[model samples]
Target: MQTVNLGILAHVDAGKTSLTERLLHSTGVIDQLGSVDAGTTQTDTGEIERRRGITIRSAVTSFALRDRQVNLLDTPGHSDFVAEVERALGVLDAAILVLSAVEGVQPHSRRIMRILRSLRLPTLIFVNKIDRVGARTDELVADVRRLLTPAVAPLGTVHAPGTSGAAFRLYDPRSGGDANRLAEALAEHDDRLLAALVDDLPPDPSHLDEALRAQATAGQVHPLLFGSALSGAGVAELLDSIAALLPTSPSAEPEPRARVFAVERDAAGERVAYLRGYGGQFRTRQRVVAYRREPDGRFTATRGRITRLDLVGAAVDQAGPPGRAHGPTALTAGHIARVTGLTGVRLGDQLGSPAGLDGRSYFPAPTLELVVRPRDPARTLALHAALLDIADADPFLRTRVAPDGGTSVLLYGEVQREVLTATLAEVYGIETECGPGRLVHVERPTGVGAALEIIGHGFFGTVGFRVEPGTGVDYRLDVELGSLPLSFHKAIEAATRAALDQGRHGWPVTDIRVTLTHSGYWSPITTAGHFRDLAPYVLMQALAEAGTRVFEPCRRFEAEVPTDRLGPVTSYLVRLGARIDGTDQIASGWRIGGLLPVRVEPEAQRRLPDLSSGEALWSSAPGGDRPMSGDPPSRPRTDGNPFDRTEYLRFLAQPRNRS
Candidate 1:
């Protein structure tokens, strides 16, 4: 009768989808589980996802465990697909962070955890691949403590293979070896349970489970479960844990307000938004409010209503509440009710005033970016609209139309760029030519740049900035100006956001703060866009004279070989210009860490197959900038001449060799 929205997360190729299949199969959600290699997994639904054998989009499925309904969101593990993961987290009450028992914590895993911690979501760890050689649960737990989280504690054991071909009892917590650990860990979190244990009183397992679930939801402790999802050894126990420990969706909270996590257009040409309900129950034909565009650009608010609720095949309703109304469920991830009987509801629009309690406002700014151009100039406008639809569906995507008329969409990694390109052609009838992917960077001036007084079309004011590196990784903007009204000051804050949304590279800027030391407003006729245009120009002028630098992404690489391939690994690093930071000699091979430019990461992807002989783990991050040599940092580069949009398009159209 209750629902748990749980997202299964892991680093790419760490067997997340495999575990998902096993969960579906073992729980009887499906008669037979499909494999990733075979491309029949339910969660890998997109065309690109099937071909790539990776989850490019998030998929939702539901099953029953001990009378509770579990709605599982399987997200893409690659960094490029982090946008999907971010959206999934927004709707999820808890997470099951899957880690490779053989390899331990990875970069993408750490990134996912970073977001989980940022959102303050309760978490559980699933150490999978227990059947593989060198998959030591104890060592992996230690690694998780050292690298991921110290709060992670094991739940139970899964049997590994013995001398016989058949796997014996892997490891079960109830088998005395670690059966008492779950009880001890659960008791430590609850004072009453701890007292019961000390007084030699028999404690109820269900009561202890509820206490553990509360502790996990509060971010106090993250329980760990071990399994080999591919071998289906410990999957049943993992499903049981989900039923016992994960929190459930509220029955009747408030008005039906939902965060649209994903946007998908089905074969029927209807938009399907993956919705995470916050307060009220959303039913068919219920109207809601949507904020379509920013205030600066023809700001508009409209209304839309739900048309259909999607579910996963016949197995969906079996997990529903007793005597509940029966409905057809979309095979999409999460609770997605279609927007039908709508006139104006736009993407990223909140249905009602959001509740202030425990709600987060923003997602992580994108760390990667690409300049996209339509192969045909005639399709430019069409492509731009398509991108907006996509971005509306996925709030994590930040886009801005440059002054030159080129549109740049920020993505998290290479896979996203690929998916976008493929999707544009398939869904929108547009073939887009993409420039080389670049690490999205923010520029902060180091000194006082020029101050200019704006006396152009319906705007007037002098904006000054004594720019410098902000605390940690931010840009400090100090402004001095004439007197302005309090309402005008608020307008300046909104204008600063508009400026940050579209930086020089068509990417959203971050780590910067602006001071309205001097502020002013024109006649009431002047609108938000007037301030928006003037603000970015003034900020750009200030940044040009002040020094700016580029930031590259860093990677933590894990490689396993026959010990003979160590030299080859070094050779690969040298050729790729990656600097070695640390190395650990493992029992079978070695693990290494280094700093690598995110742009050239595709090479690491290709070489890892041969270098490790299919035994390698790779993860990387979008890192901060390093110091520039000699002179002060140069002016940040813009996309192209603002007056000539065609020039940039021409450049993008040319082949790399020709360029």
Candidate 2:
């Protein structure tokens, strides 16, 4: 049997979740159609999801379509939950991008399509809400070509659109014009077909059908379809396209290989990992090694044993307990499964071998940071541990602790902030007091500098580093990596970035090159512990000598306000330091788009409604940093003031740091 790990994505209110429900019901997986408004959807089983009427986590369900077993992953659509969508992207075999016919092309929709095309992942566009007023398929097709891609093939046509009686008619491949159109669309990328089309030759209808399917599979062409997931219109044609056009799963490799895209816990409190099999099969109770792809492009292998395995068909509540899973069996390649007992497995870990991962991130790191304190104050340690656990579940949600024992976490925007606050109280039972959001700025070296500490210089290990401005975190060594014990080397290398996390001015330093200029240790006395403490001590000295400059975070924004209210909205945005780049007249309002300092973004969003009398729409995504013209903001000193050599050494002597 063939398997397809299909992902369905969309902007919020685009009806992707509804489409998932429609597909499930049509395939006999659900007895009754699920409703998002009613919070009865099969995939959105989370408490917050049901309450907010939005998907915050990626949910999976499986159903058989003729010879293909479709494992459908319904991903979150809110901009704040892009991290959920990002994880799903790494595991999908092909995707169906749902767009609202009424909204036409949206900001987030464009972002999703851009990533899909960049990955060259096979995509099929489904223009939904054909039954809603103002729905226009004819013009939206042109918009998709102009804004998203030109490699689009309209798989069918819509009739009686924008009404309750709307219907869809798929193109008949056996017809003369339909066959010619398919051949012509493929000809844009196929030289042979282009030549035959130029000669006015009638290509074999079956051959054209095969060519269209092949091109779609290759991601060179996207077959577009129209539908209303609510009314169940155009769904049959979509299933037909999936079974006939999408590529089937490949055979498994001899060495079991897979990539963990998500991690969850069952009611019994077991760590369950969702892995996309790439090269091999994982069996029950099988001993295995997992290669975790760290954020720094380093792959670390950890050993674990698979205690239990479950297929995609049986799943409920990625957060808690659910339907009985069918497993404790072998999970072969091309299939997705929930496996247990691999406690060391983390999200994005490559199991068995790294066959198809590049270790490059598609999303930017969060720039907003907020200092958080538990309302009870005594739950401080609990809050920190809870944060670490949450970060483990979704690596993008990072946390940092201050020297004063205060806690702070990275967040994307206001929505995430609210979600985090609610989650800590709801899930962990930790009521929290969150401070005002502060934009996280970064510092980079201003010049080159170096520092050193030899073994006899008050420490057990000898460490030194040279620092210079560069991109990301580049750590090279003047000495061989084999010069010291691997564990010792790992200690210093790991602490190198942690040292940079809090520079002399109290901001995370970036775009720096650090080289190990000296490495020596006493044979018996020197250990990884000594190196960990000593490395940071030396690195910070080098960074202080080099000096650093701070830059502020910015965001790209799109806003739509009533044409008459545009002036007031623009004025409010400008007051928040937004730079207007372009403005266009949209159907319902004036589409005002620009770049703005992220530090002022939250305030802008808060006031946008009042400025437009609650008739405006706005969205913003992360943007490149801008040079700070004024004094740089200082973060609450985390890392116990690592720049203070004497104080830091004394702090390291404590039992907590010693471990």
Candidate 3:
């Protein structure tokens, strides 16, 4: 059978999991339907997910749709877990972007669409929940066109929507306006269709169907389908559209390779990697090379043996501890399999070579950090280890353990913080107290500053660094790269970058130039640790004299609210430190555009409903940077206060701080 690695995406509470259940049941994958409210869904296997009635992790299940095997990846809908969605994006052949007919196009929906468009991923829009009380048809379609995209081909129209007996009817292309709509949409990209329409030739039904599939498969036009995943209204029609519109997985490649999109530890605590093979095969007990690229564009290759391998698919309960795979010795192209014994495997690792993989990120990492402490101080190490495990599964978290044993975590929003604390308690048996979230900022030097580390500092190495304002991280060696040894030179370079993680004001220092003016070490007693220890003290002191400015990430926003409510909305935005740039008179209201602090955007969105009497839509994009207003905020230092000489020496006295 053919394979379609399909991804279902949506904003939270949009019935995406319901849609997954409907698809599975209709295909005879299960005997009874699963309910999200009851926490009996097939994809939400974790205890917390079931209790909270939300998907916190991405889950996968396979079922037969017609003659094709659909590997459905059900991802988390919450914005805080968008990084999980980002990881799954690479393995998908086509995607169903779910939206609520009642809520219309939401901020997260728009964001997901923007990413899909950027990747040119073939997508189909499902306006679900047609039977819901406030579901809409025409007005919702208009919102999708204006906000999401203009190239949507409506597959059918709804009848008696928002009622239990709601029904959907596919368009009769030979009869009515559906033909005109499809032709017009395809005309922009299809010359033949454009010519036929221009010649006043309304093509036959088969011709229109052929044209629709071709355009949709190429990601030129999105096919729109309306349905209620709850009542199964229009779901069958939507399935037909999916099979008829979307493309299948790529043809096989002879070279042996697979890309790791997810990493999870099984019940036995063995690291298991979920990988999709692009070509060739990986068999049990076979050695494979994992190639991963760092943020700096350098690739690292590690080799490991696959002691165990299994194909990914569940027998009865698709949600039950995903990766409950069927024993399989080898995984070939177009197949997803879980393999164990790849000890050093990581998320996004390519098994083989990185030749054909794209290591570029579609989104930036979370820019907010919070210090978390274990309530029981004895469990601090355990909490840190648990956070490390979570970070392993979701690398975007960027968990850090301070030299003082303080733990900090990066997050996308407040929801993640709550979820994280609960997870640590329930899953990891660690109670925690989390500090307030702070925006991560960066610093750039205003002038030049230099410092030197001599033998008198009680270190075995002599190093000096001159710091100046520049673009990007520039490191030059005034002394020879091999003056002492290549190891010492590397230590100083790496330490310089690490030391810059926090500046004079506790923000990450970037966009600077640093030259190692001097370097020396005692013959054999002096190790790389000496230079590593010296590099930070010298660079940070230099940074202090240089004087740096802290800048926080800023959000560029645009909002639409009723004309009458514009005053209050404007005042509200201003209260949150927004700089209003312009306003234009739109059809239903005023379109306001401006920049707002990134941290305050969620609040603005939460308050928008009341401000505009529940008719306003707000959206923002992260861009640019603004000077942090008022007193500069300080982030929790993980370096044990290197600026103070006494603390620096005292911190190094501990065994854990030896590195």
Candidate 4:
């Protein structure tokens, strides 16, 4: 059987969990449906998720449709858990975007749509909650077309009963007008279908299905459907559509390659690495080589064994409870499974033969930092150990121990902080108090700068560097392959990364490019270690001469407030340095959206409710870094010239005094 890896994504309260339950229950994978509100959903197995009624982690479950095995990854919809959503994207073959019928296209939904487009994932939009009052399928479809992409083609619609919410009919696409329209839309993109349509021949169901699959796989078309997962309406067709329209993974390879997307410890305290096998086969106790990219742009390979294999959605015996281990000994390609005893396995690690599968390209940076204090100061080391475990599972949560023996955790937002606090107290039995939150800052080069340095203190090495601002959120190092010896190139790149970790302002640097313009060393005295140690000094000197600018993180937010309070709210936001881009009048009020400093977001959240009498709704997400207003902050330049041997020696003698 072929395998399909599908991700179900949406904004919070969009009924994504309910839809997952309906799909599982309709396929006969489970005897009874689990409710998200009741905290009984299969994917939401975490206690914190159940208590908060929100998914904090991405969970996986699988079921079979026809001859295909479909793996469903239910991702968290909350903005705070976007890092979790990002991790799942690297492994997904396709995605299902859920939109609420009543609410229409939300802020986060639009954000997810952009990411899906960037990833080039074929997507299907499911308009859920058709059973509720004021559920206008037509308006919601129009909203999606207007706000999102115009390439969306509706597969079917939901017809609601007059009196009852549960009784509804999902018109078959074969008999509806949409079927013809869908065929036309698919024909516009598929040459074969277009030729047949132009020949005045009626569309064949199989041909149309094939065309839809082809167009969707290429991300040329997105099919939309209407349903209510709560009422079990339109669900059967949804499953059938997934089985027929989605593309299946290619055949397994003779030598297996797999990518690890998530890593965590199970209830038994055993480490589990969740992976999707792109090629080859993996067996229990199989020997595999894990390959990871180092800072110097090289692959580091480590040997490990898969001690156990747990296939998702394996069948349960009649006499056993549901979800009991079926004990699958091996997993073939195009399959998702959990394996144990991979000690060095990390997120984005590739296992087996490294012929395919790229490393993780996206890593969400934590926007908020919290100072954590343990109730018992004596147990500080234990708290740090516990935090390391959590950090290992969720790389977004970066933990650090301060020089003063205090601990801090970098997180996404307030919701993540709450989840962390609860987890620390309940799971690890570590009582803690969190301090005020602060926004993370980054530094970038303001303009082009260059520096040349010659080692004088028995180093016997010379290095030259040029610095400039980068375009994206990446620290780029450019050097010709044969510019220098391979060993020197490696050492220079690694040292450059270490130097970039801390800017002169004591914050990490981002979006900057450094080039090793010239380099030389004496064969007798110069070594890779010497180059590595001296590279930082050269890079820092170049950066200081170029001058660096500090940029605080910012987020764009939209809020719906009463028209009467719009003037004051707008004025207040403007006073806080917000740039209002647009405003639209809604039924109840005005919707305003713009960019603002994240540092002031909490204050705005607190004041907006009171200003609007608790009648306003708002949402925000990371919008990248922006330079601070007024005079751009700059780091102190080095007083002595790097080319002057005497001045350079004096500067190195008292680096702290020179700056």
TM-score of 4: 0.81
Ranking by lDDT: 2, 3, 4, 1
Q: Is candidate 1 or candidate 2 better by TM-score?
A: 2
Q: What is the lDDT of residue 182 in candidate 1?
A: 53
> In model 3, where do residues sit more than 4 Å from their true spots?
196-199, 313-328, 356-359, 402-405, 446-457, 464-481, 511-518, 565-568, 571-576, 602-615, 629-631, 643-650, 653-656
Worst 10 residues of 2 by lDDT: 320-329
User: Once superposed on the true structure, which residue ranges of model 4 sit more than 4 Å away at CA?
Assistant: 161-164, 172-213, 253-255, 293-300, 314-328, 353-364, 448-496, 514-539, 557-576, 579-594, 600-620, 631-659
Local accuracy of candidate 2 as per-residue lDDT tens digits, 573-624: 8877788999999788898989998768878889888988898888776778
Residue 519 in candidate 3, Cα distance off native in Å: 3.5
Instruction: TM-score for candidate 1, please give it.
Output: 0.71
Writing each residue's lDDT as its tens digit, candidate 1 over 1-659 gives 56678889999988999988898888887898797988899888877788889987788877777867677889888876666776577678788999987778888788778777777787888887777777766677777876687666576555543211212232343344343455566665678767766776666656656666787777777888777787777676677667766677645454556666566667777766666666656666566665443422323456666676544323425568863435543222234344444433434454544442232433445755677888898887898898888776666676665434557777876667888889899878899987665566554435545435454433454444433444322332344323555555455556555555444444344444444444445666554444544555556555555544544445444445557777788779868877777777877677777766555577878887788788776665654444333533222334332223355335334564121
Q: Candidate 4 clashing pairs? A: 253-280, 256-280
- Each model's C-alpha lDDT? 0.63, 0.85, 0.84, 0.78
What TM-score would each prediction reach against the true structure? Answer: 0.71, 0.88, 0.91, 0.81
Which residue pairs does candidate 2 place in steric collision? 256-280, 257-280
Model 4: per-residue lDDT, tens digit, 1-659?
A: 77899999999999999999999999887889998879999999889899889988888999999998899999999887777787788778889999988888988898899788777788988888887877777777777886678778787656662224643344344643545676677777777757756785556677677777877877788888887888887787788778867788767777778888778778987889998887778888889999876433456788998888887766667778775576555677778889999987766678886665444445347877788888899879889998988876675677666545668788877888899889989889999988887667878888888887766654568788888887433434454667567887778777677667557665667777787777777876677877775777787778888887789888889888998989988998998889898999987789899999887888999899998989998877677778886664432233233334466456656745321
TM-score, model 3 to reference: 0.91
